[model samples]
Target: MRKIYFIALLLLCGNLYGQGLPGLGAGTTPNNKPILHGKNWVAITGKPLGATAGAAIFHQGGNAVDAACAMIAATSTMWDVLSWGGETQALIYNPHTKKVIAINALGYAPTGATVDFFKSQGMNNPPQYGPLAATTPGTPGGIMTMLAEYGTMSLEQILKPSMELAKGYPIEAQTANAIEAQKAKIKDWPYSKKIFLPHLGKEREAPEAGEIFVQEDLYQMLSKLVEAERNALKGSKSRKEAIYAAYDRFYKGDIAKEIVRGTREQGGLFTEADLANWKVKIEEPLHVNYKGIDVYKLQEWTQGPALLQSLNILENFDLKTMGYNSANYIHTLYQAMNLAFADRDFYYGDPAYVKSPMKGLLSKEYAKARAKLIGDMNDPKITAGDPYPYQGGTNPYLDILKKNQTKVASLSPGQINSTLDEQFISDFQSGTTSMETADAEGWVVSVTPSGGWIPAVVAGNTGVGLSQRMQSFVLDENLSPYNLPEPGKRPRVTLTPSLALKDGKPLLAFAVQGGDSQDQNLLQFFLNIVEFEMDVQEGTEAPNFNSYQMQSSFGDHEIRPGAIVLRKDTPEWISKELAKKGYSLEFWNKTSGPINAIWFDWKHSTFWGGSSDYGDDYGIAW
Candidate 1:
């Protein structure tokens, strides 16, 4: 019956082939299109196995964190396209504490990486491929950290399904397509090619959709961690201590050594200290009060704040009055997004190195002032604002802000490599995997794990991989405060996950993986629920639009004025109207992103879940 409904929905919705593989489409899809509902819990993830693993945890009486971690492990092992060697960033809501927390699972540049190195190599930006593109492995550590700190289950317990998945899982078409698409690049690294394109007779070919894809090396790696924890348990260590033992085994023990050894040998710069010293920090999420509801985001290190800024600006208008998907709403959204993105490009960076001006950025007064700059018609030029005075407080990052100010490059063709550089940055930026879970216990988890991608050169024989995150770092020494490559400094990343609270209670948890397109897609999802009154699934599948009119978050940072790409099925009248208004309208034939979201109705004490029809998006309720 579910299969029948799924086929019907696909026929009704049309082909989402355009959502493309990992980063191209809306980030949600179903192997079976029937809406999944559960009175106890629900799981939505990038793969069927992920949803299954997460559901198993929930059935076993584990909390949301445990289920989410299990989902991460399963997806990381199976969905090589969305996340392989990727880092993780998550927004988790603890029902007990009633607090929303942000987890920064990303890694920084190795100590030896420097501006001089890229400069000497005649590269204007960090390399988008090979060892230099790789960053320290963070997925394993991040998942383990989440389980250890917030979960009720032990690592050994949560990872059983993942261990089985690692042994072998049938490759789906999307996963197969992703691997085959990168076959040339995979061949560049002997290790990656060996794992992704194992020999079936002499000629290398991508596994057929139903062929069993085995990761024996990855299986061994996971087994060792579980073994480490089991061994520790034999010594009568506490579960927490045993989890730590397993964590150390990856970051400080043999796993770390192998990662460092292979990376350095391949001319990458990771060190033993890089792995040992790295830890995922739990952070207070930055948030804004929007129509009495609080929308949470990660700090300046990610593009999360831009969504808040855009929302704040949009709050001034009655979106419903403008109508759903109306020309006015689209224009207003594009202009507001332009303002927010301009500020994001100028001000968003690692708080440790750059003062993000968060107070001013999220302040209502600042949004008002910035909103005043948006015109009814599209403006192609970049228009960043001054937030220091409007912030209502002294700028804490004054010195670094001044340094950043001096290095600003005027938007020019020379400063922006529109092709090679743009493609590279866009390709590596937010390419990611995502999962969302909600438990009857009131715990909600939204996790987007990215990094270790096809571009990465696998570190030796360790089935473990690294992320192409370092490629997100800019090479301009003059822009040191914002994007200069430095040891121990994490690149200003594009991975942003979101959680929302209404009346001081959890309302929604959602995330997507379109690099810069993430926040834009999410903004629409939020509006669809709050303003348009669409259910979570309808909102998630709604037609979406993204604009590149502002400076991009990565690479040469080009701002393409008036560039707007709408999904093909968007009303032709609306597209024509926007184009008439001097906006460059391009139709994207593929479906947009796979946005995964779970809406919590505290009043009804119920959970609603929705995902895309990309086949990769899987939702399960139990």
Candidate 2:
């Protein structure tokens, strides 16, 4: 009965062509745009302009990877939620090779970012804003690497749309509001102020929705790469060599020098060696088999495994029998998510530095044992399970866990110390944008681009932005390999991207941009599609829930026990019932996620795409 109703609802959606979600600046665009269908290629991004740019690239003789790179570059230029100076993490699937590659393009801590360095500066945790929070940017290198290895276009061509957009593009209402919100932060940094808040003769203000906002400095920064690529192609250089030239220009050339100088002059510890030494790592994806499908994620460095662990526990139950979003379904989902997140808090970190037992954590036996801990009532405590006992492996984090579990401060020392610090205000927020692209040839790319917000200082006059990823690092001196401040360490990031394969063929690619709610958003959306059989857009539009039972990956790693918030659109009775079951309930209009995803039906030779209505997420195909 539900399946029949969903099909009928999809028919109704087919007529609401291109309509934006209510109150999200829907404009007067057509309302009949349903799940976009494509024959050869399709692209979807957090912004419509970005989707158009990427689709144009695909139509202009580029492949899926090229289109994806182009889309990321275009979105970065819009400068609302994403910045060119930010970092990205990607999950790419190549059907011809039957390979799913995970790209950890997240920025790394600078060489001087040791624990002693912060102690010497009388700091406990890393700074929340300014140059001290900055890291060696990995976005440029990540994109360049994708172009050289998998893409069929030069950096010059792929960046053309972004370069043009940077010169000037009509701003949107959402972007204008974002700029307005960051005015104070922009004013604090002269470089950010000059770029985002332009002076119109006598007065300076954020750009209006319809205004043509120009970014000459950003254009100059991007133009340097094109020039370097062109120069490298002068004689006997391959396209790959030209791409490397462009990459080196950003990481090892004048760009790197300017970043190092500006950062150092502003009391930042980043140096030329830091910039030159950083590289994007390509690793095998961390995956879990769920309901006969293989779900892959960005790896342990992020909250990716949390998604797998949650799904592992969920797979033990008959979700369809529980009914979609029913009281029982919601309860079981949160229990599984809480368990997985508990493990994430305790075990997930950069595998290079920490010994994360992947095989043990994702095992079905471990999940069953963990699921048994979820009682008939709600669990308010942040309890983590012992996967090592089931897998016959010794616990690596045992000593630190025992030492810090009880003593871990409610708030990190930095959060307490920086409370009155103007630079570290409570209202500050950083954002990220997501882009996904796929072609009929079976190539799929899910990229989450982030960083370079007004909160972080710009790297000199080069128009480059640096990441404050260091803020996610824990600053305690407990001697734990995980979550410590150390040089060359990748912070436990929340930038999780996902891919799903059915019978060894790539079928779905998706990702969203929410700091703490990323995994929860993905989990709900995944269930909507897999169990409920909802189409991409309907699943994205579905009311979502967020559980705050685990430690946050951002500033202070605050934990709020038994607190679960649901979208206001959820039934009121459900909230009341969950509250009665020892769960603290709250209502929010939007907290779970604003997700974007693409589904490929290889047997039908067609593509189906969806984007959340929360933002200006746009989906297009050709």
Candidate 3:
């Protein structure tokens, strides 16, 4: 099968130059489509089933926020990779209020969770089992928070579409692959396996293009929420009461007991108290100034600080003049990324537990100092800097510059040679997750929910697996001081949803799913639009690159590996130049991070939307 696929690719590659991939053009069937005007909306994701749910909400007179909520609920049913019982972070742009609010729906460690708890358990690090590893899920609270603050539609209206489809949506190849990959874990959870497996009591193969797939338990959960919402609207209870009732129905009622019982049977530590006491936090959004624009990000509980740091470094570069995907542009991006990552490794953590110098790190003076260290157009062998040293609330800058800068060059026209060859395996596996975006009336909503730790958590009533998450923390003795494990502290996360603005107007809504690659993908996508002025599709379809020279939750912590992977579409000359600049290139079939984006074309008065080909879906309507 591998040979057959490779041979087919080679045959296609024979005509790859000038002749693009079959579905690369506009209005491409299935992969790309144009929607009719109806408050101008489009939904794009990693699966068709998820997109259908978003589209249904738009069809139901629900605004983007309503549509986003529906889609998130639906994604849980379609892809176990993103479950409703997980953490979520969103960025909502309210045009009426002229504000972009960041929602931190990330889970927090249980009050009993701590490094010493693990130590007492004969575990050197946080255990993946029981109450110690389970953080209070914030997804439910997040959805409710958004609805109360910005939504005009009731929860019943928003949840109806997903409820109807939860029992089944047309399963596709991608959905099947996702299920099969995690079948071992799924089989352990009776409820999860019942919905995912076939009548033969085995995980089914990838479904054909239009086969129905059902998640009955999940459908029931949605139905209960809808009922609660209706009951709340009758004036018998307050809105908060209705929301909590629905939440309780899931966590403290039958479902909660099922989870607790299952975990206990499996030697896990979740308790009824943990579930009842779990509450999502409504914290302040981390704010920073990037090129005069007030950029709002999720708090450091996730990797939001790294994004701000990247923006700080980028503020000093003239990215517009560097041109799109040019060597100079890419090099500057890498340098900025390197600098941000350095701080991310050393100083980033839950601010409540660790005194992260996030404010000082994002200071303009610190950014300027870091900026001066890089030469104009030459690739440095190694980019190094301190993680924001403090002196009386300010850091001093030292003048450092290199000579012999190279001039930026235009991309040469020809067949671009891709860098993704077969020898690229370095155990650096990054997987696709789930995302949703909606705007009701003028209120915008975005959600990026991911299964960071997989294989340990099953998808259905047997409850979601969690062992993979435990492996995400760093255990280096030297870095042990920074390792995550604290009561009420959120682990460093990578599922990021972002909103971009121009001249104080919401311009772009976007996010990507790829573990540590999340922020890097975000930076590249942002630059593709804001700096290069590319259209939404161009930005989504650009040949992207990422550095493996840094440590991540998934890779070896080494610096001189020189491993870099570029998309198959990157220009050949660019690849050569990169190699000459001391990058060790590893080619791949495709290096993709599922990125979905919506661009507001103010001049045209239309919204252009796209989802990465790296995933299964991207949709739009206007």
Candidate 4:
């Protein structure tokens, strides 16, 4: 009888018209749109403009990898908030290699930069400028690396769509809103204002649905890269050298000079050598096994490790048996997330500078130990666990103390001694703050590039300020016993791209875009679908919650506020249950971080794709 019921459930799900759970509606769009509705592959993104560019590449015989490159190029021009020129991180699954690779397109601090260098200069708070703030821009290098290793199309071909769009693509409401939000800051940058604003001194408005917008300078830049590639192909320059030349043209050539001048004029620190020396690092992707399937994520420099840690913690629970979205399930997941985030705050950092015990943090044994702390009965106001020690005989608690001291000196001398220092108050005031896991077959590419701090000191020839990523660091108040100033490392990042597979084959790929909310959102989305059996649309649209009790690059640290934010659509019952469990509930009209996803239907050998309706965008495909 049990077997018969299981078969019935499967049959019910297969028939769309049957009394089955909600499923995503099917659709098709031209190849110029990034939505590819093929039986073998599909791709989706947060913006129609990006999706359109990727779709064009797909139609032109480019595979998923090529489409991804084109999508990112176009996105850089359209989504200014998530700028492509900043830093890019990606996870690519190559069916041919049957292996997953992580591309760390993120920039690193210049070699000349040290914690003491700023202090010696009498700079209490180092300006987010100059060589100190600048890291090697990694987007260009990362793109080239992926194309060289896995992409089929040439650079010229992949970049063409973005180039054309840059010449002029209609600005949308979302883009307009973003620009308006930053209007005051952007006006100061002549280049940004000139390119983004309309003629007659008026700020450009998003085109009414069907209108077209264009960025001529960006188009010229893309064209220049293409021209260089063509010349290099015809000349003696190697492909690598040609690619490098193009990158130099953007960063060290006239364009770079402009940025440098602007930065220096603003008292910022970025030198030509900083740009020249920058390169994206290629590292082995971190992996974790969940429910018997291998899961892949980026390294510690990113929040990928945290995702794995959370998954490991949850592995001890049979989610299916807990019941999807039930009070019990939500509490369990929240507990696991709290524990994972604690580890993320304490240990995760740039692997090059800090020793992160990633292996132990993601171990099954560690997860079990953490999980045993959770009560199956009531949700606690706070979840606590002993600090997981780092290997090599280093205690994390001591490290935290040292980190505190170093950060205090950077902010204020007295700030280190007291948690409630005025410097802490000022630092809190200074706070400023993508998902497709798809294979290359019909690639679902999700790329998120973010600009660091505002008012970059780098000057462009056009007098535009460049990105100031150096602000990403947190100063440690504690000094090493050796008297070396502790450099506050890059906090655990929230950017993570993930792929889910079943039986060694790619089943679903998805990611989210909210700052620290990325991993939490991704985890919830997966659980909504795999364990809850909700369809793509339902899963993506479901109301979500985020916990601020753990450490974050943003928000209050000491008071784990037990806050739970809910979307407008959260069921009343769920809200009541959460409130009953001592969760401070807050509601948001909607959250940012548009999720794009693609799923494979094994029995039919067809592909399905969906872009979040939460934004003013649509998906496309051939």
lDDT for every model? 0.77, 0.77, 0.61, 0.60
Error of 1 at 254 (Å): 1.0
Indicate the residue-level lDDT of 397 in model 2: 64
The weakest ten consecutive residues by lDDT in model 3 span 399-408
TM per prediction: 0.89, 0.90, 0.81, 0.80
Candidate 4 — worst ten consecutive residues by lDDT sum? 477-486
Taking all chains together, the TM-score of candidate 4 against the true structure is: 0.80
User: Over the stretch 340-456, how does candidate 4's per-residue lDDT look in tens digits?
Assistant: 876666566687666667767777887889888787533333333334442234554565555553543365323222123343333222211153534336344445555433323
Q: Give me the overall lDDT of model 4.
A: 0.60
* Candidate 4 Cα errors over 4 Å, as ranges: 1-37, 110-135, 199-214, 236-241, 251-258, 376-393, 396-446, 452-459, 462-465, 477-492, 554-560
- Over 1-622, each residue of candidate 3 has an lDDT whose tens digit, in order, gives 9999998775454222223332344333233333323246766666666777778777777777777766776665555365555666788887877887777766666555665666677775554323334565556666766666566567777676666666677766666766666667656655555666564343454344457876666666667666766777686876656666677765677666766666556545566776776665655667676765666677766666777778888888777666556666667777777777756654556666766666677787778887776664333333334444632343222211011011102222122222333323332335545554545355666567654233334423633433234434544433323546665566766666777677887677788777667788878877666655555666676667776544465433333234567776766876787677656676665565777877766766666676777666656564
Positional deviation of residue 412's Cα in model 1 after best superposition, in angstroms: 9.7
Better of 1 and 4 by TM-score: 1
Summed over model 4, clashes come to 43
Taking the candidates one at a time, how many backbone clashes does each contain?
Answer: 24, 7, 29, 43
Ranking by TM-score: 2, 1, 3, 4
Q: What would the per-residue lDDT of candidate 2 be over residues 1-622, giving only the tens digit for each residue? A: 9999998675444223111123222222332347788889889988889998998898889999999999888887786465766788899998778999988788888878887888788877787677878767878888899889899998989999999898899988888767777678767777777777774343437887889988887788899999999999995799999999989999899988988887887778887888788898988998888888899997888888999999989878887766666667788888899889878877777778776777888898999888887776776654666678777888766776665555543545333221122222121223577888998787899988777755557777877766777877877735235667677888887788899999998767888877768888899898877876667777777777777777666666666666677777666666777777777677767754568888887778898888877767888887
Give candidate 3's whole-model lDDT. 0.61
